[model samples]
Target: MREIREFEERLQVENTSGEIPGFLHLYTGQEAIAVGVCEHLSDIDYIGSTHRGHGHCIAKGCDLNGMMAEIYGKETGLCRGKGGSMHIADLERGMLGANAIVGGASPLAVGAALSARTLGTGGVSVAFTGDGGSNQGLVFEAMNMAVVLQLPVIFVFENNGYGEATGHDYAVGSRDIAGRAAGFGLPAVKVDGTDFFAVHEAMGTAVERARSGQGPSVIEAVAMRWRGHFEGDAMLYRAEGEVAELRANKDPLTLFLQRVEGQVLQEDIEAIDRQVAAAIDEAVERARAANPPSAEQVLTDVYVSY
Candidate 1:
């Protein structure tokens, strides 16, 4: 969580300082959801992410330097600086990339699950979508197909109250996103996203079910985003001081610390913090020194010869 926080803080600084070229959807407050689900996944498993995907990429073990460079549009990035912050992908790491379009990667994860089922790879795929995205027709279609095929997939809904600037209450017609999964004949569960252990335990069961060929399941993680939908967004849709209050009281990192305070030593936690901070600092330095992709390379990755 500290690593994700530091990475996003650097991006915030760079975006405001004009160091980064494009827009970014930061994964600021919803760190536990990604970490918890990904703890049970391997490189063989696939995960399709949303616009707010930095945390997912980090949790899946993508190189921090490469990801930072990708956000900076440097040639040394994961996608040769082509995909940018919203489209970063690394197939070798089973990260199917973060989609800029709302609920765009749902089918991709479903496709991956289908492929895994057909090939007998024993791999599971996860689709990470937002509350607003859960309303998208494509997500429902994907869920329906996963159920019919009994595909190895997990539909993870990170219900962070608002979709973009609109509140979920205003946008979604359903009372609970996970409840809709039952309509598709899939097991559904909801976990408190603020608590890492809760999310981890829930995801463990979901992942095992998918791997065991019990078909896809849905998990709605109730959390909140610390930032707006995108950088520079004024977030006028949210109530004044609501974000501040959540940050102070409902922060996942803080909650995690409180939960494990007696079980873990303070010095051990501090040592891990120091290590993550230094590593993130080094990644930032490397990204800063990296060169941007040349103009000639723009057409290189855009086409393929038959």
Candidate 2:
């Protein structure tokens, strides 16, 4: 979680300084959702992410240096800097890229789940979407199809309150996103996304069900994003001090530390923090030093010659 936070903080700083190229959608306060759910997944289990997906990539074991380089638009990045922040994918790690379009990964996750079922791989696919994405018609279609085919898929709704600036209350028609899953005959549950244990437990159940060929499940993780929709957004739409209040008292990392206070040593935790900070520092330095993709490579990955 600390690593994820540091990654975004660095990106925000670099972006503000005009070092990072292109638009950046940061994943600042939604660490637990990725880490908690990913803890139950292996390399074989698939996960699709959103525009704000740095946390998901890291949680799924993507190389830190490569990701930082990718964000920096360097050739050493995961996609040779072509995919940038919103489209980092490592299929070997089971992360099927983070899409810029809202709810775009729903169908991708469904397809992966279907493949797993057909191949009898016993692997599950997870679609990580936002509150705004939950309203997309494509997501509903994918959910219905997963249920009908009994595919191993988990639709994880990261309800961070706003869809680019509109509040969920104004945009979402459903009272609670998970409630709508009943219409599709899937088990749906809402959990405290800030609490890692709660998310882990809920994901565990869903994973078990999916692996056993019980079809899909919907999980509404109620959390909030600490930053605006994008880095440069002024965020005038939000109520004054809302994000500040959450950062002060409701931080997921802080809550997680408090919950695990007695179980782990303070020094050990501090050591981990130092290690993560150092790693992030090294990644940033490497990304800064790395070069961008050459002109020759521009049209290389765009189309197949054959």
Candidate 3:
């Protein structure tokens, strides 16, 4: 929770700098989903992210400096600044990349899982998509393929109520996202995404199922998006007092702090907070001082032996 808060603060700083190029998506309220799922994963396990992916990157052990640099469109960024905020990637860390296209990464994750299965590697692949992407045909296709192949994959549906400005209630036809998983002939679980323990426990089961060759499972984590869909959204679509109420009552960071009160010392958590703040500060400084990509470099990577 503390780490999540720190990430949120860093995102705020990056967004406020007015230097972040292209679309910027904030994961203020959905921290638990990323942290919880990644808790059971290792560097060998692969995970795919969405546009609102900074939290996922952070949770997956992405370098804060590189992420900040990418957002700032610096030459030293993870994607050499070409990918910007929506397409950051770190193959070494098992992050395929953050897909700008909705529902784009699910099939990629399935492919990774299929490779893992065929190669007899113990690694697993996870697909992190939101409620909006869940409606896409690709998600269903990935689910069916995963189940039929019994690939080592976990489908993490981060249902944050709204798809951009549109409400999930209106966009998603189903009452329960997990119920749809049953159609794929896979076991599914629905959890409170704001509660770290709940997400952690559910993901633990899903990961185990996938790793043990029990086939793919769907985890629908019901959460709320604290910030606007993107950084500059007016959020007029949201009901009055809805966001405030969710922050006060259902914030994942707050719930995790409450649940782990005794297990983790306050001073220890505070130390992490301080460290994360310093890291973010250093990242911002580095990004600001770094140079942008050269014009010639763009054409260089576009072709093969041309």
Candidate 4:
């Protein structure tokens, strides 16, 4: 969780300084959702990510240097400097990729789940979508298809109060994501996304069910995003003190530390924080030193000649 948080904090700084290019969607407050759910997953498991995907990628074990370099458009990036912030993919690590299009991850997870089921891999696929994506027709279709096929997919709707700038209250017709999923004939639950233990417990149940061939499930992680839809967004759509209240009351890191205070040493937590910060600092330096993709390398991955 510290890794994801510190990574994006560094990104916000670097992006502001014009070191990183392209539109960036920082996963500032949604760190626990990814980390908690991914804790139950293994290298053989698969996950589909969102445009705001750095946290998911990190939680799923993508190399920090490759991801930072990818965001910086460096030749050594995960996508060789082409896919940028919204499209980093490390297939070898079972991250299908992060998609820019809303609802894109739903069917991607569906496909992966289908393959897993067909090949008897005992792996599960997860789709991480935002509240806005929960409203997409493709997402519903993907969910329905997953139910119909009994595939091992988990639909995690990280409802962070808005679909971009629009409040979810104004957009989501049902106003209840888990209830809607339950209506679709799958076991669905809503958990406090800020509470890592809650999310981890819910995901553990869902993962167990999936691996046991009990089919797909839905997990609605009710949380906050702490930043704009994208880095430059002013977020005028929110009421005054909205983000401030979330930061003060619902901070995932703080909540997690509080929960683990007696069981884990504060000094150990501080050490992890320092380690994550230094690691991100090194990633930034490596990205800065790395060259952009050469012109000769540009068209290589863009096409399939065969």
Q: Please give each candidate's TM-score.
A: 0.97, 0.98, 0.96, 0.98
The TM-score that candidate 1 achieves is 0.97
After superposing candidate 1 on the true structure, give the runs of residues whose Cα lies further than 4 Å from its correct spot. Answer: 304-306
Give one digit per residue, the lDDT tens place, for model 2 in 127-180. Answer: 999999999999999999999998999999999999999999889887689998
The clash numbers for all candidates, in the given order, read 0, 0, 0, 0
Please write out the lDDT profile of model 4 over residues 272-305, one tens digit for every residue: 9889989999999999999999988989788757
lDDT of 3 by residue, 197-273 (tens): 89999999988888898989999999989888888899999999999999899988788888878999989888887
In candidate 1, what are the lDDT values of residues 157-258, reduced to their tens digit?
A: 999999987898888787689887779999999999988999999999999899988999999999989898899999988889998999998899999999
lDDT of every model, 2 decimals: 0.91, 0.92, 0.87, 0.93
Question: Which ranges of candidate 3 are over 4 A from the true structure?
Answer: 302-306
Clashing pairs in 4: none
Q: Which ten contiguous residues of candidate 4 have the minimum total lDDT?
A: 297-306
